[model samples]
Target chain A: MSSERIITVRALTRVEGEGALHVRLDGDEVEDVRLSIYEAPRFFEAFLRERSIEDVPDLTARICGICPVAYQMSSVHALEAALGITITPTIRRLRRLMYCGEWIESHSLHVFLLHAADFFGCASGIELARQFPQQVNDGLQIKQAGNALLEVLGGRAIHPVNVRIGGFHRLPAAGELTALLPKLREARSAAIAAADWIAEFEFPACEFECEWVALTHPDEYPMNAGLIGSTRFPAIEVDEFEDHFEETQVHHSTALHATRRERQTPYLLGPLSRLNLNRDRLRKPAREIAQRLLPQRVIHNRFLSIAARLVEIVHCLDEAIESIQDYRAEGEASCRYAARSGRGCAATEAPRGTLYHAYEISDDGRVRRAKIVPPTSQNQRQIETDLAHFLPAVLDQPDDQIALSCEKLIRSYDPCISCSTHFLKLTMERR
Target chain B: MNTHSRITAVLGLGSPHGDDQFGWSVVDALTHCRRALPSIHVRLVKLRHPIDVISWINDQTQVHLIDAAVGCPIDQVLRLRCKVPTEWRTIECLPAKGTHDLSLGTVLGTAESLDKPIESVTLWLGPAQQCSPIQLMSARTAEAVDACARKLEQTIRGAGPLADPNSHLTPQSVPPSARAGAVTRAEDFDGEMPDSRIDLER
Candidate 1:
């Protein structure tokens, strides 16, 4: 007689957006695993059709509230590429600064409010806060600093209005940028403390034989611009993305799953991937913090993603402070560009991972076609792969503990199902 | 009343879809009418998610939250005064599912667990207008927006609850007629209200 069991979580809590995990087991042997993302399709690609190239930044920003800057940045870069517009160094630096704000806020929110509870054996951040109020407060303060930066740069934190195709509608005054320095300085300390605090958490020991992919720059850590590279593949230009990767419609999920076209295998893309590929590119304090937290240099344990996120937060804060301190307003807020018939693609490092945006604009500046491969969709296959590799070790644990661990593993990726979902109810079955 | 510890925060939680924009519309209306209440310092926050209310209420003693309550009568306005739980162990009521998963009640419950506990919380809720094409508020929901703002003003002024016999109004007393048609067009509110609706097929 074959023994069988089933576990189901109707709604996954703590993580942004909705999704579910289903695992099948026959006795002690794992049969199958799936991360079904049921977030409703927003038809963003279709919506972009016939829309003016200028509206791309603002429209795509709504894809995910947590990482709107990522969308805006990716869209603008793609549109600029199509229009043959090159923004000044000032605009580029400011774009990086804006991205830093997103990374800080998003990483802090995930590390403290979302993923911290998993390590502490709590159900939610609310439960974690009850035990560690000071930690939660510190996290909130750090998040606020990031939000303050967003408000200063983009005008609002959630969906910023300042981002434009060639540049910005307005540049921050030197005084305005200077005022944020002190707060960022304070936040830098807070982020450092946070990194120290999260470094102490006991992470589960697990490693995968999967490809790690991220945007790689020559001089600095990838944020606004870089070439897509992975341990398995050579650096590829943005336009070569669809040639290397393919998004397929899976029956179980509303989100389209992405894979490397050559191998049709799962690849990891996120903090772990970024940190693994661009560890040397991180700035001073962040580099120091990364060394302290991840002495091994390459993190194989997926659970230690919280540590990577903390390291990135430190990096972003440091970068933000430096950017603000060296603030210089030069030239027009945005350069003039004429939209012509062309195909353009851009890949940028979102808070989660690399976000790829491709657009074909008509001669009249209207968007003819658009394709967006969000990080979560790209990570979906890898998530399922991780689960298949991860569950075998914890098969003997209590079912509830197993479920909790599964949720933790998923959240470790900081999957923004809100962007990919058109969403999770976890279910486990043993037969 | 010590002004330092007393933070009167008004959070309008809504999306940019039809009547769901009630909370945001009400707050927009209050911004124009805020000059009338000079004695109290009110912090107005426009939020897309209910969980955001937690961050907005930091160190705030009195908080007024406005949101659209779906399934309620089209023109009805529901106001409830909430009690902040002092202890983490005490399980406060969670928010009902509104436009988002993290409801106002859930945020407040989470907020109560934090170090800062709000003393008084008033929720101003109006009917969610169900309409296709998703642009502005319906004429009915527009009226509810104005009434919601007026109620907030009245509450801020400490007008002793403005006794009302309406059944929809709870925790605070306001006249039945006070919940009448108070509306504003979406065009009147500045800033883009992006439609948050997604086409989902199960």
Candidate 2:
């Protein structure tokens, strides 16, 4: 029998981007666990400096192929704040509708293709498809519906070219928007079924009392814009984000780990946090689904995140239908703005979590400085913390099973390491 | 059957990473010559995940995947026929070096299980020498991109008269090299190709 052992998973599967897990064990006691993010830095912030402010939306959207709209939305909102431009109600509606497309597409992908495999005891979607053909087919169809919605509004699904600083470069014609209703209606049923399916899965027994943070809005479930709120802290304005949260560099990872400045502790974000923070704001169908599946107003189970994502998909589909029904194409696609020398910050809930962007623009329209705090970076510390708490229970299990459980926990966050470090290589060892 | 009637799909599976972009460039080149080639119905798709090609396989008779593979000699391009699996099982195949977690064989296996298998599948692989984070495409990969495109066009044109363009091909009848088993390099093709030992379906 080994006295001391190290378990490392070289490349974790299913999740977007690359990352590894390292666990040091002494006899039956878990000594240390580190979720090291080895993705290479792409210097996005440094590249943003001196670039034209007008080009920010398209340029920043390249950060994550999975959630390009999130990057575009956060960047545009920050630049608009700097320029002191208020878009019209119609433009706002269109932006929200676009955001709905992203949420539905991204959430569906995570639930069906990525996270669902773990529950079925499969390594990838291919394995899951072999066992549950109908389920995988339904998931693929649901994903297609989401992609179709994106194509209608954004021209192309991945790295959409239609979004601009003030608004979309070209708004979907009324007929174009109306045509998507039938598919969305069908997808609503599929999403509801997905929620129920995931709810039936046997989840691991684990809970951690940590700070749950997300954007909160009075009238709607936050997406495009909102005040940042945490279970422990009051809501703060977008501009006050840097004042409350700080990003610190760690030696093991290329991505910066974020923490609440005052408490200096990790906080949770993403679907679970968002749902916990704003369950009441969900629309009728989604609210009912959440009530049936979750029951509790505040959920602490990380594994129930798949259920949360499905509910959010239902909400987004319903919201998109409503927005399209109320659409009137009266305003210009984008509002014109002149460059001004000022600093601006804005936060929007990316599919993974709250994505914050801040920019200082020069009078000549060039970017003087830029800061982008992706949700993955914000959740890194919390992920590490979760791993530390999670390892103790699984220490007695076989090495492979323990590694699988750890991978599942990390995937629950749906962490998009690509958005932060731009790369990931996973390694696991036992000695 | 009209010799001109056949559905051919060229899928580019890659990211914006250096040399990885070679696949996209090959597809782009094929698309540029779309109008000149009236005999073939060409559909082009850019994919982030290898599994995404599964959806595009349903209606097409033949699918050509162009991607960058590690271990191949620099500036060299290799054409290999992919072996589609007959029995459905969990795909535990390892992906090519520098590729995503899911391998192309696993995706094809999953597609077959879903009853959407394509009759003929080919891989036009360019050697990936430089695959850094920020770099777009290495000069060697850039050169191989156009050459691979031209070779693909030549092969499609030389594939002889179509035998029942609309007929569904049984798995056993697929050419020996393109049959459902193991990926094998084209023995009779030109170019300085190295012995390939990468197991696509494990």
Candidate 3:
């Protein structure tokens, strides 16, 4: 008779928000794995109803402190689509610049502070800093450069008060944009070095088949606007997102787990997904690094996502510098639009992954309904599936070792539990 | 680039809501009193997260951190002068919870780990209750905030010779009257100090 064992992590640390993981095992066989997101539903979507359409961007921006710009971008773009407003070319470039700041800040924090410690077996980011003070300092400086960009562009670093429905409430001065050039240049160089350094770290050998999903743009790497592109399909309009994808409420988690309607299986998103779908659109330096380090056209190794984040960091810094150099206050700060009843949807590539927002505006410009699908929620199901596949090899180890391995895998996804319930304690049972 | 400069940063950590706003109120008071002591180069910064204290610590040799503490008797002010910054977790008055995962303890630990240029750390904590998220600050907490601010103001005023890079301004550096009610650590308290890791979830 095989013995029954269960491993449970009551509360997971080092990740954002509250969550737990449970694994059930019978002898050598993996019975079940669940990434339980226990945080209460924040009801952002429900509360957004009946609010004025103009307030959607600001209101939604409060959803997540770490990725406020992404929320603002998705909400504003979706609202603009609903209002039928075409932003000017300069406004579009500025939006991209704001996104560059967000990506650099969010990705840098995850790469160095949250995720890197796992690779070194360090207990915390502080422990990692103790050993690699220079790396941690570099990361903080890079993050500060991003924060400076955000403060200048969006009016504040966290939950920017400047973003409006059509465009910015105020434009940055040329000097303000020019001032960021030196910092952005330094960050780009640091990011390139970090990427090369991370690439040399030994990743745990594991790969599982899952569809890669991301927003794809023809002219540039996707940020503000794009069509939904996946490895299994060509491309679909943001309007067609619901027709292809579905978010289902799982019993174990408060967050809605996403899946393809056709297959009803977990798919992947985030840095790896974006890299796989849009590698060619990367900025020249990022592309060169990606080519040299990651030569493969499609990267299935989820652990390499850290490397992907660093690559994107380098890319965003380069993009930010270029945008600042070419910036000008052209036309009006915002586009002119009138209120009318319409529905629109938009997807922007957030630091973690694609963030989709759909809004229905009343003729009087009040929001009738709001649906926001944060990247963390979309990735939750895939995390469970990945854990199930990845746990078998480490099953022979002690329960604590197994739990640590599971935590390492989950952190690799950098699941923001707070965002996902809009979503790991780990439990392993052997029978 | 003078690494030896004596820059004293008084960082007030608090949220905008209810008694949690105690730190901000004290900082606001100090900002008003700043002009009175123009000779002292004390920088006052209001922060929402403890980790943000790191950014201001880079150039400063001496630092004062002000925050509100729950689970203690209201109107009482607690002070801890960190001789060893990494032992911040030993303070029972510290609200173990952080803005996300970065608590004051964690921030102090990180600062020590990074070896930031700092000479001394004085943490001033005011007793807080009813830290309601959206409600205005409680009256008692506001009174406590004022008292703490006055004490800090006197201490900052007494910290002279701002031009001297080697000079340090700790709470003990001032006269006994400036730190009359301040306790050295949780162990010295006449009353029972709660666990340092006060699980807020409970």
RMSD of 1: 7.0
Docking class of 1: incorrect
lDDT of 1 by residue, A98-172 (tens): 999888888887787778888988876678888877777778778888888888889876689999989999998
Best first by DockQ, ranked: 3, 2, 1
lDDT of 1 by residue, B98-148 (tens): 212334544555576784555456666676655222378888788888777
Q: List residue ranges in candidate 1 displaced over 4 A.
A: B4-7, B34-40, B58-61, B70-74, B84-103, B129-140, B157-202
Over A1-431, each residue of candidate 2 has an lDDT whose tens digit, in order, gives: 76555555655766666666667665656566666777778788999999999889988987887788899999999999998989988988888888888888788877877788888888877788888787777777777777877788778776788988888888789999898888888888888877667768888876887899999999889987789988888999888999999999988888899999988899988998999999999999999889888848578888888889989999998998888888977779999887789888899999999999999999999999999999998998988888878877987787767877888888888888778773233343444
Candidate achieving higher lDDT, 1 or 2 = 1
lDDT of every model, 2 decimals: 0.76, 0.74, 0.76
Residue lDDT tens for model 2, B94-159: 322222244666567667667675446666667576667547787777878877777677656653
Number of colliding residue pairs in each model:
28, 13, 23
Question: Model 1 chain A: which ten-residue window has the lowest total lDDT?
Answer: A417-426
